[model samples]
Structure formats: C-alpha cells, structure tokens
Target: MLIEVEVCDVCRRLGVPVTSYTITETESGRSVVTVRCGEHAAPFEEVLGQPVEAVAAAETPKPRQAKKAATGRQPRGQRAERQVMTREQIDAAKAAGKA
Candidate 1:
C-alpha cells in the first residue's frame, strides 16, 4: 500500500531517511506514521507536539505480472538435423538418375 503525506520540515532537516518511514491507517479512521531513526522509533500522534488531524492511508494498485516466454520447446542445439546433401552424394545421385 502507498501512503502519501507531507514530509515534516523537521524530519527533512534531520535528514531522516525516507525509506524507513511507514504509514498505516486504523479501523477508527486514524492514520499513523511510523518513523525509524537508527534504533529509535516513533509514531506521529501530534504535529509540533499538538494533537492534529488524522492522515489517511493511500492504497496502491496491484502491480501487473511480467510476461514470460513459454516453456517446453526444444532448444536450437537439440533440434533434429536439417537435410544437407554433400557434393559427392549429389553427384552420385545424379549419375544414378535418382537426383
């Protein structure tokens, strides 16, 4: 799921790695943003230490599956031999009137 939110200026100032942040919405219509900074973890219950509006979680659409080549056909190296008549064979067959 994708959750979009305005990054806090403080977090931006701290150079908080965005990859460690997560967003989740509860059944009560409340959104939670979890931040991990090294070994420390915190949840946003307030903005600037004051109770704030709830943030909604964003839903991401399922990704499409990649197409793959079909299996089970023989490889080129394992295919049956192609008909290739040698020069002597052709000459002999022509001399025998079977060309």
Candidate 2:
C-alpha cells in the first residue's frame, strides 16, 4: 500500500531523508504542518513562530534509485561493397572527366 508520508521539511531541502523528528504547525493564516529532524524543531519554531506538537518516529525514506542502464547499442550494418575498378577503368574515368 502506498501511503502519503510527511518527510522532514528541513532535511528535504538538502535531499536527505530523516526518520526521527518533532512536528509543528506554521503560524500563519494558512496553517502548514512542517516536520523537522531532531535538531530542527527549535529552529522551525523560532523561524516560523510555531509551537511543537510532539516527537514521533517516521520511516526512513526508500533508497534513491540507481541510474538506468544504457539502452541497446546503436544499430550497425556492413559497408556497401565498392566497385572494383582496374587501372584502365580509372584512366577512362579520369579521361572522361577531362572531356
């Protein structure tokens, strides 16, 4: 089951996953719930002027996916065969070009 989970708003800025933190609500007309890592609770409160709700346990974010392997190599084919020209044929072509 896919559940919508809240991650640490602060840690998310750094693209890191945090599992433990305290939750707090932002003090504004539009109330927003901001989750913070263990160390960010005080900062969030001080910055957002919000009060802490409670400390809770959150699941660690799933590991980032690895870069996908390259698709199949570019298609290739054998070069077309070249015409076999003798010295006489070459001289004839050169002579024709001079005409």
Candidate 3:
C-alpha cells in the first residue's frame, strides 16, 4: 500500500512545496511533523524550538578588503570632519608628488 504524505504545513502556509521535513514529539506525547524545503527548514526549526543541525561544516569565506586608489590617496568624504582637505591643496600635493 502507498502512503500519501501531506506537504509541509509551514511551506504550504507560505505557498511552497514540501521537499524536506522533521518529525518531533511534544512533551505532551503529541507527534508533530513539519515539512519544508531545504531553504526554509532552518526557520522551521527555530519556530519548532529545535536546534537546527548543520548539513555540512563548511568554512566561511573571509571578507575581501577594499582596494586602495591608484594615486595612493585616501578617498574623499571618508576622512574625519576635523581633517578636511581642499581640492586645490590636494591637487598641489599631487603635482609636487608628495601625495
């Protein structure tokens, strides 16, 4: 005999299809089943007050550093308000190769 399983309650409420699921028994001996796609399972675990297990312990990639300007000068508007430099002064320093 073929058994038909219902789509995940959370995903169905959110208008999505069921692809993954978890069955849990409450303290009161009531068995509750939750169905969700892989993407929604984490949130479902939070709703069910269960700890979500990591599928794979992949290392997170390090964040990339911002590239420096070709002229070796700090970008404008990023400086502190007390250390403002005028365009003319900056141009003079660049021309004198002191920037």
Candidate 4:
C-alpha cells in the first residue's frame, strides 16, 4: 500500500501535532509543492494561491506467493508411476523364498 502525507506548517509553528494532508503545486513551473494539514489548507491556499491538484505516481502491486501443499504424500497421479506386484507375484516370490 502507498500513501502520500505531510505535516501542517501552522501546527508546527504552534507546537501542535498534525496528521494527513492535501498536496498541491503553488507555481506554474511546478517547482514549489505545498503539503499541509486540513485545518490550514484554506489559509495556506489563500496565501499561496488555490491548490493545483498534483498527480500521484502509480504504485505497482506486489506479486502473491504460492501456498505450499500440507500433505506428506505425493499426488495420486504421481504415485501411480511406481511399480507394484500382484497377489500371484507375491505368492510366487514367497514359494521361491525371495519374498
């Protein structure tokens, strides 16, 4: 998540804490940017000129991680590849004393 925020100059001068602000450009050249709290926005705008809405840069979203499987065994399809003997093979092996 991305957020744009600034401190109030008036509050700073008054030794008071402030949070959240509206951003603006005060000059035609876009050289001066004014960020102030809501309480002082109108007053600051009266002096610096009406706020020229500033464009915020787009933030790229992060990629999500893939969840790992919790089971301690492989999928049925994968296990099917293993070789297994039938009952007859087992019996023959037992008779041959190789079981």
- The prediction achieving the highest TM-score against the true structure is 3
RMSD value for candidate 4: 14.5
- Predicted candidate 3 versus true structure: per-residue lDDT over 44-92, tens digit per residue: 5555564334322223456899877658666865764576789999999
The full ranking of all candidates by TM-score, starting with the best, is: 3, 2, 4, 1
- The local lDDT score (0 to 100) that residue 28 gets in candidate 2 is 50
User: What overall lDDT, based on C-alpha atoms, would model 1 receive against the true structure?
Assistant: 0.53
TM-score of 2: 0.25
**What are the Cα lDDT values of the candidates?**
0.53, 0.56, 0.62, 0.57
Candidate 1 per-residue C-alpha lDDT over 1-99 given as tens digits, one digit per residue, 9 for 90 to 100: 996653343444354443345455556666655544432433442332443432321233568997554587665446666879999999999999998
Provide the TM-score for each candidate, comma-separated: 0.19, 0.25, 0.27, 0.22
Q: Show pairs that collide, candidate 3.
A: none
Least well predicted 10-residue stretch by lDDT in candidate 4: 50-59
Write one digit per residue (lDDT tens) for candidate 4, span 14-43. Answer: 344454444556665454444456576765
Which residue segments of model 2 deviate by more than 4 Å?
13-28, 44-99
Q: Which ten residues in a row have the lowest lDDT in candidate 3?
A: 50-59
RMSD to the hidden true structure, all candidates: 14.3, 18.0, 10.4, 14.5
The deviation in Å at residue 89 for candidate 1 is 99
